[model samples]
Target: MSEAASIAEMPPRYDPNGVEERWYLKWEQDGRFKPDLESEAEPFVITIPPPNVTGELHLGHALTYGIEDILGRYTRMRGFNTLILPGTDHAGIATQNVVEKQLAKEGVSRYDLGREAFVERAWLWKEKYAENIRQQFRALGCAFDWSRERFTMDPQYVDAVLEFFIRLFEEGKIYRGWRVINWCPRCQSAISDIEVDDREREDSLYYLRYPLKDGSGDIVVATVRPETILGDVAVAVNPRDDRFRDLVGKTAILPLLGRELSIVADEMVDTEFGTGAVKITPAHDFADFEVAERHHLDMPIAIGPDARITEVGGPYEGQTVSEARVSVLRDLGAGGYL
Candidate 1:
């Protein structure tokens, strides 16, 4: 018989669509994906990339498992022993977000549920989703060693991560504090720079006044956010600005918010931007953050993580930041202080 005819007569080498479920269950129950130290055959292994726990099957997953399966199955076909390791990132932020969303639907917050309860919910969610993922991988016929599955957030795995972080800190490579972190509102966490993609577009600029402490007149200042006015801590100008040289030692009455602030000269101020003066809300903008740090100005965050005006924002408290901005501007303009 011809080779092609012989193969065709060989019952199709067992159709996966027909036997995949039964064989996969049998293989998993038999621990086919487990390591065999007794095997002396040349070992080949390939680890798959970890995807987010909430992730659905995408082109990336397809391509990744496809290539890895090719290598693993090819090596086994060549008579070498093979193992394909599979895993995923615990991805704290993404997992936490999923839990938080569930909590939100029931009108409860994570803080109310406590860490343990929230975590339990997350594990339940993880278990349900992980099974789906395993099925998807099986459907692809990837030969991964399922018994040795590693989760990045598993207790054993977390110990390694904690140990690494401790070692890195000891080596002076890692530390923590508040800074200009790119925070994700949905995730309620600070994401690394690698996670951020900036797109520059047109943004409006607002000109307003920070009146002198004596109520004489006002220092005209420019800002992109009129809403940040409630958070203003200082009005800054170049130290050498001829028009405001005498105003260096003075104070400015913060409009609407009534937060008294100083008129200070900072070298970082650009002489060419908006009346050569800027209103500094240390809690809001990056430049103001640096200016506050250098000037030892009190920097209290006036906007909460929810991006609402915080309690320290006085009358604007509890309002969405954008709404607070409009209200503050109208109040200021109505009072003839705009």
Candidate 2:
């Protein structure tokens, strides 16, 4: 056999492990991954969903990167000026949690380090994780424009975000007010609704009796969150329900707080649900907030950001939601209101 044919026929081995680094280094060095802005080729762009700079890539990340790489390669072959811009997210709350856990190992809190020092530590963490992610992407043969790599916390990005916020404020689209929001007590930050995970778990249902202002019998309300009962401004019942139709327009005395709550009729109440009555705690529950708005009722905040009962909770103040639940349930049983 000829020398070249003999060498080629000896063995056929596909070894990406050996050649990947060399090709990636050459491609980056030659700037082949960068889009030719001056080229007349039709622009084809794909940006990666910037992964959090708090951890290494997982299987899901690998799958997404592979799909994007395929698209980038296909577009490039089709005579298009393809650009795959790579970036990492600061992942504010998530990255903070990581650094906080590291600090916890030394029996220290972020407060001990102060804001500036804590932020410095977080940037260091981001650098480490971000590099790790880049290395993983390179190993996967992802053709990304490293020249245009960005971070969410970059100065330019921060300025852009501030500009957007100011624009919304000027447009009267942004306003700050006390509203029921998903809160993470551990992180001590208000999280968006999308960050919340909904799941079914076994929880206790507390059946409490609210005495009528009139010499009539008490009305029962079954709730899983008795800790919020202290914030109740009204007792809501379905207007169509014959059982509570006459009870409407009267007042109910809140058991523990002794607060007078109007017995209001709202079509929003689910009569088929437990007790056919619902307690309106506008400050704690979103549905209750809407009812409060409609009825022009007060919104009493009974829980603070720490997930502890606030001063509005009276004697239960300073107790965590779980702790207050036990106390409230015990008191209800003692008073024969359960």
> What's the TM-score of each model vs. the native?
0.65, 0.87
lDDT score, candidate 2, position 65: 89
Candidate 1 wrongly placed segments (more than 4 Å):
1-49, 64-85, 96-121, 138-145, 180-204, 212-218, 236-251, 257-276, 294-296, 305-308, 318-323
* Per-residue lDDT value at 306 in model 2: 88
Write down the lDDT that model 2 would get. Answer: 0.92
* Residue 332 Cα positional deviation in candidate 2, in Å, after optimal superposition: 2.6
Worst-scoring 10-residue span by lDDT in model 2? 9-18
| Candidate 2 per-residue C-alpha lDDT over 219-334 given as tens digits, one digit per residue, 9 for 90 to 100 | 99989998789899999999999999989999999998899999999999999989999999999889999999999999988989888989999999999998998899899889
**Positional deviation of residue 145's Cα in model 2 after best superposition, in angstroms:** 1.4
lDDT of 1 by residue, 127-238 (tens): 7777778778888777788878888778988898899999999999999955766777656778767567888889877778777988677889887788887778888999
lDDT of 2 at 122: 94
The lDDT of each candidate is 0.82, 0.92
Q: Relative to the unseen true structure, what is the C-alpha lDDT of residue 247 in candidate 2, on a scale of 0 to 100?
A: 93
